[model samples]
Target: MTAQLANVAAVHADEPSMPGIVPATLARIKVELLGFIRNPQSLVFTVSLPLLLMLIFGSVFSGPVEGTDVDFRQVFISGIIAAGAMSTAFSGLTISVVIEREHGIIRRMASSPMPKSAYFIGKVLMVLITTVLEVALLLLVAVLLFQLDLPATAALWGTFIWVLLLGTAACTMAGFAYCALIPNAKSAAAVTTPPFMILQFISGVFYPFHMLPGWMQTIASVFPLAPMTRGFRHVFLPDTFKAVEAGGVWNLQGIVVTLVAWIILGTFLTAITFKWRGPRVR
Candidate 1:
């Protein structure tokens, strides 16, 4: 026993140290992202649906933003971008996690040596990738088919990045936390879609905010999706489009604060409530 112990200790001493968390997590993120891309339904939901929606809405709607020379198609571009982000980050992520848990993937992963942080890092990276693709495709369609003006100034692009980051973080974390409330994969859409679908109209994804009743506007403003969409509009739309927004202009600072708060609170709730395994079968 002593000889075996000594040999094990010598081997351990000679072995190289493992890679750091950041590198490992990044590698895992790539793997996870590839898995997402391989899934055809994920691609359809995340990328194709939003693009189709943009095309349909942009085709049906026309005219300047109440007073601006910028076409209404440009406004639809921003709204669809926000919709894509929310679809991928919140609805997609939540359902993915719940389904994985239902199938024992999360339980297997929990038993492995992989760091828990890597799982979330992978998820967030996937959201970022999918969201960027959705936005790029939407912008391409806007420029090619609609002749919409893309943001030219560095400041405008910077605002785009800021809004994207905040929206992604808020939606991803909230999705993670919300997944804990799901009972099974079968009920995923039942729990996920109502809010997302309802938010589409109230949050101005399909209609102008000013068209909704005052109470509806108030209710929508409190949600992350509404504020995130409005924030993107602030970046992409001409300033004159602000006349149609509920408050006469997007509250850029307020949107950031609300998204940040959701990130913090969602992270806390997810850490405590997320399940690594499906419920015990009684």
Candidate 2:
């Protein structure tokens, strides 16, 4: 008994200390990024599809918005950028988590020595990085092809960064929570895509917010995408274009509040619902 105890103590002394949360998260981020790079089809769907939509819509609606000097293409570009971010964060994350759970990868990871929070942090960070890339690509195209204007002031630029981060975080957390509803990988798209599509349409991505029916506009206001779209527009569109916004003003406070609320709710839901194993697992 004494020899066995001594041997166990020696083995414990030889084992390296586990990394801190930040380091573990960063390492996990690297792994997630490498996995994403290897999956070219994810890039095609997550990035390419949005770019295609931007080109089609931007070209189709090249004229100025009705009653405002702001170009419709500019509005479309900002709206699509917001929608694309949500797509990468919410839809993409949900599908990925569902598939991982279904494949037993999540279960294996849960049993691993790595910090459990690292897995979720890595997933959300991966989505944020992809979202940034998507937004940059979309903005580059908008600037080159549609002549969309960049944010004029440092303050506007600051707004852009915060809005992007907060919106992405809210969507990421929501994705984690929503994935619990998915029964398996096969139904991921069926469960996630329709609501995303509907949000885009109602949240002023496909049409101007002011133009949507009052009921639809009110419904869209309850979701993160509408406020996110409006926030993006505040950065890109001219002040005069505020006339076209839901309240005829740039309600920055409302946008921030809505996003923060969603983030809180999503975090709570994720804590309760998230499971390492698939729903069918015993």
Candidate 3:
């Protein structure tokens, strides 16, 4: 299966781009955004999952972090938020790219005169909008359903947005890396979603990180998903919950290290492995 997919990719060699466009990046973003919003499944999962998780977990937990008085809902609020963003940014893009390749959209794209930078930027723009809307929807739910308050300090709010932006970028890069490695567009979900779901469970989205067994906590902390969720908790709540990972401060140091490292690793892997097409072409 792998060798067959590699040959298909080698055969296509060229992924086309749209030509004769006015502001191609902006145009492409609009097209992509329209397609995504029209997809009902995308709406439910990307936009609804965060809100749903916030409601359910907030009601179910009914209290603070195990070791501290800090509200677990307040802390896990960020985890759910991060998970939603990660899913949209990662699984969504990987699957989209795979579908585009299978359908000959990328082949059509490479044949066009539009620049590769423009095409890629357009995808990022769509991601940016989807992420912003998803965040807004989830935050509203967090406030009303989970009682998770937004950061009152300007500095924290700024940091929250920055962390979210960087975190989303990291997830997107990972998605691209998966896109590069996987052989068939048809298998994209088969390859991506199970791990994504499992990671959410282990990354402390469904439970507090420290509450998990020690070995599980260790494994989760090393993954980008856990770090991003923890960093986001710092941005959203009091410092107590982030203490689940590190003892004090906002732990900006830990967040910066984790996200930057994963972003770099995923980026390098993607560039080395990404293929534009399948060999079989069918």
Which ranges in model 1 have alpha carbons more than 4 Å from their true place?
Answer: 1-19, 65-70, 280-282
Deviating ranges (above 4 Å) for candidate 2? 1-8, 11-17, 280-282
Model 3 TM-score is 0.86
Query: What is the alpha-carbon lDDT for the whole of candidate 2?
Result: 0.90
Model 2: per-residue Cα lDDT over 1-282, one tens digit each: 999999999999888666788998999899889988888988789888889999999877777777787778888888999999999999988998899898888898787777899998898889989899999999999899988899999999999999999999999999999998888999999999999999999998999888889999999998999999999999999888898776689999999999999999999999999989986654
Q: What clash pairs does model 1 have?
A: none
Error of 1 at 90 (Å): 0.8
Better of 1 and 2 by TM-score: 2
Shift of residue 105 alpha carbon in model 3, Å: 0.7
Q: What is candidate 2's TM-score against the reference? A: 0.94
User: For candidate 3, lDDT tens digit of each residue in 1-282?
Assistant: 999999899877765434544487777898899889899886787678777778777888867577888876777778888998887889888888888877778777766677666666777677878988898888887787767778989988888887888888888888878887677777888998897888888887888776788788678777678877877877777765556564545568777788888789988997788666665554
Q: Rate the local accuracy (lDDT) of all candidates.
A: 0.84, 0.90, 0.79
Model 1 TM-score relative to the real fold:
0.90
Listed per model in order, the count of residue pairs whose N, CA or C atoms clash below 3 Å is 0, 0, 10
Q: Which is better, 2 or 3, measured by lDDT?
A: 2
Relative to the unseen true structure, what is the Cα RMSD of model 3?
Answer: 8.7
Instruction: Tell me which of candidates 2 and 3 scores higher on TM-score.
Output: 2
- Candidate 3 lowest-lDDT run of ten: 13-22
